[model samples]
Target: MSTHSYDAIVVGARCAGAPIAMLLARAGANVLLVDKATFPSDTMSTHLVHPPGVAALRRWGLLERLEQTGCPAVERYSFDFGPVTIAGTPRPIDGAARAYCPRRTVLDALLVAAAVEAGAELREGFTVEEVVADGGRVTGIRGHARHGSSVTEHAPLVVGADGRHSAVVKAVRPGQYDERPSRTAMYYAYWSELPVDGFETGIRGERHRGWAAARTHDGLTVMPFGWPIEEFHANRHDIEGHFLAMMDLAGDLGERVRAATRESRFVGTSELPGYFRTPYGPGWALAGDAGYHKNPITAMGINDAFRDAELVAGAVADALSGTRPLDDGLRDYQRIRDEEVRPIYELTDAFARLDPPPPEMQRLIGAMHGNQEAMDAFVSVQASTLPAPELFSPDNVARIMREAGADG
Candidate 1:
C-alpha cells in the first residue's frame, strides 16, 4: 500500500479517463490517472469523431493541438443506400463544423498530454489488480507497475474510464441491463493513396451490409463490416477473403480498394455486445465504454466517450467539492448519459443487425435524397448535435413533405 491520497483515482487513461482527470484537476482536484498502456500506442477503433466530439476538444482547448498533428478535418459526409444517396456538410456544434478520424496513436496521446498539463498525475504501465473497498465503499486501487513492485493509491472516488472490457467494472460488478447479443462482425484496414477527395462516406450495399471510408493518420481507411453473428466462427479463418468479398457490396469503394495499395494488415472483431451498466455505486463510478457501449456501425464511440468524460468530470467535481452527495451527483450523471445515449444506441443496434428497414423508414430515408436540410439534420443526429427525434418524428416528416410540395 502507498501513503499518497488523491481527490480522485481514474483508471484507463484514454479518451474517457484523461478527459475526466483533466477536467477535475483543472477545477483544483488532485487527480491520479492510470493506464496499462503507454502514450502514442495503437488501439482497436474506427477512429472517427463527429462534430460534437470536435466541440468537446475545442472546449478543452485541445482541438488546435490535434490539428497541428496534420490529421485531416473531414468536412463532408455522404451516405449511399443503393437506391439513393444523402450527402451534406456536417452541422456545426458550438461553432465547430468538422469531423476527424485521427489514429488512436495520435488522439489518445493528445488526451493524456492534456490531462498531465492540467496537473493530473499520470501513471502509465500501471495495471490495476484489485479495487480496495472498506465498509462497502471503494477506497482506492491496488496495482503493480510493469517493472516495479506492487503499490496502492487511496482516493474517495474511483473511476473506471476503461474500455468495454474494463477491469474496474468487472471488480465492482454494478447492475447491468439492456444486454444484447452481438449483431455483426467487423473487419477493416488502411490503404495508401486511396482517393477520397476529402470526404467521409458510409455505403449501405446489398443485403444491408455496411461499409465506411475515411482518411486518417497516415492513410485512407476502409471498413467492410456487418455480416450476421452466426457467420462469425466459420469466417474467422479466411478474414481477408471474406473482407474482400464483402467489399463487393459497394462497387465504387471496392474498385478504389482494388486500385489502392494496402498499407496495413486487416484487423477486426467478431464480438461486440452492447449494454448499459449502472454508472455509480457507494464510492466508485464508470465512464465511457465501461458504463455503456453501442454498435460501432454508427461510429459514435469516441464522441460518446468525450461526452461521458465531461459529464462524469462535472459530477465528480461537484461531489468532491461537497456541493452534493457523491451518490446523488453520480446518479444524476447516469440519468443524463442514459437520456442522451438511449436513442442512438437503439438506432445503432438496429443498423448493426444488417436487416432492411421497414417500408416507412425506407421512404423517410429516400426522401432525404432531395431535401438537403433534412439530410443535414439527419447527419447531425449521428454527430450528436441534434436528438434523434428531431429528424425521425412523424411531425418532422410531415414538415419535410409540406416543404417539398411547396418547392414542387
Candidate 2:
C-alpha cells in the first residue's frame, strides 16, 4: 500500500472539513484532507446560509467565489399559515449583506477549490475507514488514501468532518454519541427556473404556498418543514405525490410551488441529535455535522460548521504552536460549540416542537392582528436573536400591556 504524511488529516472535505483544513493551512500548517465523494456534490443539508454564516464566508474570503458559483442572495422570508400571510424584512448584515441559498453541489466544490488554493492537499473519493491514534490520543487516520488507491496515510491531527455518520467518530470514540431522530423529516430538491411565487424577493426565501421555499441563484427551490419519517418511508414509492399533496395542504402558494417546477427531483433527509459529544480526544477533534446534527429550523448547521471550523482551526493552531494543551484546546472547542450555539439549537428545537397553540397563545396571536413589527419579532425569535422562552415573556407582555393600556 502507498503511504504519506502530513501535519493534519481531515476527513469529509465538505462543509466542515474543507474550511477547517483551509484555515489551518493558511495558518501555515501542513494539511491533508480526505473525502469519500466527488466535489461539487450535494450533502444532506437545506443549504440556506444565514447572515452570520454569510459573514463567516466573507471572513474566509470565499464569499465572492461563492457568488460566482451560483449563490442566491435571499432577502425576505414570508410565512403563510393558511389565510394569514406574514412577511417580514430579511435580516441584513451590516447594511447590505443578505443571506444566500447556494446548492451544496455548488458550495462544496467551491470550498474544495478554496482549500486547494489555500495550500491544502485534498483527496476526494478516498473513503475513511478509521482514525489512527496513539495512546488514546488522536494521531492519524487510516482510509483509502487516494482514489483507486488502497494506500494509507497518517498525520498529527485527524479531523472528522464527514457529516452524521462520521467514520472518524465511530473509530475514535466508538459508542460515544447517541442521537434522537428529529420530530420531522423532509423531501426536497433543486430547480432551475422555479420561484416561491409572491415572495419574488430572493436570497433568504419567501413562501409561495404554506411551505417554506426559497430560490437559489441557480434557480433551485429548497422546500423543507416538519413531516413524520414514517410517512416519508411509506410514501417512497410516490414521494412526488406525497410532496405535492403536502404542498396542496399547505395552500395555493404550495400549489404554485408544485406547478412552478418542470425539472426537479427529491432529496430525503432526517434530522436527529441527542446533543452528540465526545467530539474531541487525544490528537483529533470533530467539526460540523460530524459532531452535532442540529434541528433543521435553525438553518444554522452549515453556519455552525463554519463557526466550528474557525474554532477548531484555532485550537489546532494553538496546540501545534505549543501555546496550549491539545486536550484543553479541544475542551474549549467543545465548550464553545456546545455552550455558545446551544441557544440556536434550542430555538430550532422549539420550532420542531410546534403544536397547535393553546387558548392563551391564540389570544396573543389575535392581538398581533397583522402587524409587521409583530411578525418581525416572530421571525427574529425563530432566527434565535430573542431567546425561545422570552418570545412570550411576562416582561414583554407587561410592557405591551402598559402601552396598550395608555393607548386605550
Q: Estimate each model's TM-score.
A: 0.96, 0.86
lDDT of 2 by residue, 30-71 (tens): 899888888878766777776667788888888888877666
lDDT of 2: 0.69
**Candidate of highest lDDT:** 1
Model 2 ranges with Cα > 4 A deviation = 1-5, 90-97, 145-149, 174-179, 197-210, 270-274, 357-369, 384-393, 400-408
lDDT of 1 by residue, 229-334 (tens): 7788988889778777766766677788788888778788877899999989877999999999877888888888898898888887887778987777788888
lDDT of each: 0.84, 0.69
Locate the minimum summed-lDDT window of 10 residues in model 2: 201-210
Per TM-score, the best of the predicted structures is: 1
| Whole-structure CA lDDT of model 1 | 0.84
Give the true-structure RMSD of model 1.
1.9
